[model samples]
Target chain A: MTIITILDLLGTFVFAISGSLVARNREFDIFGALVVAFATALGGGTIRDLLIGVAPVGWMLDAKYLVAVIAGVGVAAFFSTILLKLRKTLFLFDTIGIGIFTLIGIQKALAQGLSPGVALMMGIVSAVFGGVVRDILCNEVPLIFRKEIYATACLAGGTIYLVGIHLGVNNTVAMVACMLLIIGIRLISVMKKIALPKI
Target chain B: MTIITILDLLGTFVFAISGSLVARNREFDIFGALVVAFATALGGGTIRDLLIGVAPVGWMLDAKYLVAVIAGVGVAAFFSTILLKLRKTLFLFDTIGIGIFTLIGIQKALAQGLSPGVALMMGIVSAVFGGVVRDILCNEVPLIFRKEIYATACLAGGTIYLVGIHLGVNNTVAMVACMLLIIGIRLISVMKKIALPKI
Candidate 1:
């Protein structure tokens, strides 16, 4: 299996777990937990595909993503306490996932002939919009919009990736650099409680 | 012009007006209100088209929807008090709008070869998801989920429409009957304080 596919599945799994955790905290039933998990795992990509006018969406084209989400929900259902206790580790995974998601989104949009600026926007959307949908379904202002400097990290990473590609950088090198930058920004921002200034 | 085309534009206009009114109440700036209005006006159809894998979405193909939303926002900006005073009339338009939206959604989904049941769900989605998007953007629980018997009206109408078609009814007859049923249900439900049973 390709590295991107593996990372995508892993990201989806972690997202689903996080969503199911939230639903469980709210005392939702198993079905509700599954729905939330599915949305969190696939919502961003689905929205991205919709925006780019892609048919069947990414998950619909691959059963692995759904399997990952179901597995995540199952894990969350059985080991809520364990998962919660591993918050820091899970957070680390989530940060890395966003970086990968940004890369995937940018690549997809660029392949669809979108300009770099719009592709960067799509990258941010792909990285953070699942959480936006999750928070909206949970009836809250999205964390990325309201508090975190989350999408900013993706924007930064995506821009650099685009620039690197323009400068004739190796594809893998550019992608990895972008991912590292996002991961570093997310990690540091969380540790330092850094946030964007209010308008 | 076809009646459906006229009604569709009218529905989009009213939806945008309602969205901008909410944004105005929240004291959002002009740009924010316009964003909300656009989302409220075209969000449902965009989402429906996306799910059915239609490229460029609905409004992207037709400039009329965009014009309707812009006009709605402009009216909201200039005559807030006048529009607010006409709440009952606006609410009437909103009811009719949902009916038309449901019909549009179901028809689109059916054209895409989705099952009748799934098409009915899409119809309800089309009727109400714009408000859901609007409320989410404003950081509130969607009113349809929290308080209103709103989606139920669409459900009833969509179900009847599907059944009518199944019984070999004329297309326009089934559509008009569906819309009238939705309008009746929404108006009566508001007057009688009807609600779905709590889950």
Candidate 2:
């Protein structure tokens, strides 16, 4: 697998785990936990593919992605007994996953020939749409629009990636720079308790 | 206005009312009611448009739709005191709304030059997605995938519409006939407790 594929899997696994953890926190049944994990794993990619007229959806084309999500869920379920004791660690993993996913989303959208602006939006969407769906399914307020400068960090990272590309930087370097940008911004925001102003 | 437009508006109104009623049942505040109402009114259309690559989602482009949803919530909130007594009546309205929405969605998708099979799927999606979203927000099992023949009726209607169109039937007649088909099926299913086989 290419580096991109590996990173994508990493992001998907983290997202699935975060979703499963949340379901556990909510005291949902096993079925509910699995549903949340699957939705959180595939929701954003499905939306992206559907919007771009890609048929069959991404997860449906590959069993590996599904296996990865299921593995993530299994890990979460097995470790829930201890993970619940490390809520902060769980949050860190979720944050890192968002950063990775956002970068991958932007790259894929660019590969599809979308404009930088659109690709940037797609990246943020790819990173956060799963969580949005998860929160909605869990009947809680969506975190992206509410907290952690989540979407904004993705947006900033997307901008940096585009700028790097325009400057003729190597793709790997551009990607790493943007990924770090998202992670750094997200971490700072959390530590500083920064938030977007509600209109 | 055309019969289709009138039926679409009727569907939007009833669906929005149903959403507001559910929010009230959950004792959600006014903002929550508005959110639910808006989701019920526009959720299906938004999904359809996004999937078809239509930009500037329907409600964003048309202020009237938002106004209409707000009006729906107002009506529901006003009569909420007596809405419980009218549950059966409201259920009928909601069913009819789904029926109308299904036909419109199929027609719109076909007009966009998608395949008949995809159009049929879109119809079912349009009819049921709003309810699924509403249920998710309310933290309940989605009625579409759980109880009733909600999406199946839409599928039946879509098939009929597709066959009629393929046979060169007039579009208006085909649409009306298919809508009635959906309405009749939904009414019967609700009365008879018809359900799809559980997974």
Candidate 1 backbone clash number: 0
lDDT of 2 at B181: 86
DockQ of each: 0.17, 0.08
Weakest 10 consecutive residues of candidate 1 chain B by summed lDDT: B140-149
Q: Which candidate is the best by TM-score?
A: 1
Q: Give a tens-digit lDDT track for model 2, residues B1-199.
A: 7776666776788788889988988999999999898888889888777765565666697676777788889989897767778878777777777777888777777777776766776677687778777887788755554457767777788788889989999988887788788889888987898776432
DockQ of 1: 0.17
Poorly placed runs, candidate 2 (over 4 Å) = A1-42, A47-107, A112-199, B61-63, B81-88
Candidate 1 lDDT? 0.86
Query: Chain A: TM-score in each candidate?
Result: 0.97, 0.91
Docking quality category of candidate 2 according to DockQ thresholds:
incorrect
Instruction: Encode model 1's per-residue lDDT on B75-179: one tens digit a residue.
Output: 988998898689999899889899999999999988877767668767877888898789879987566654556888888999989999999999899998999
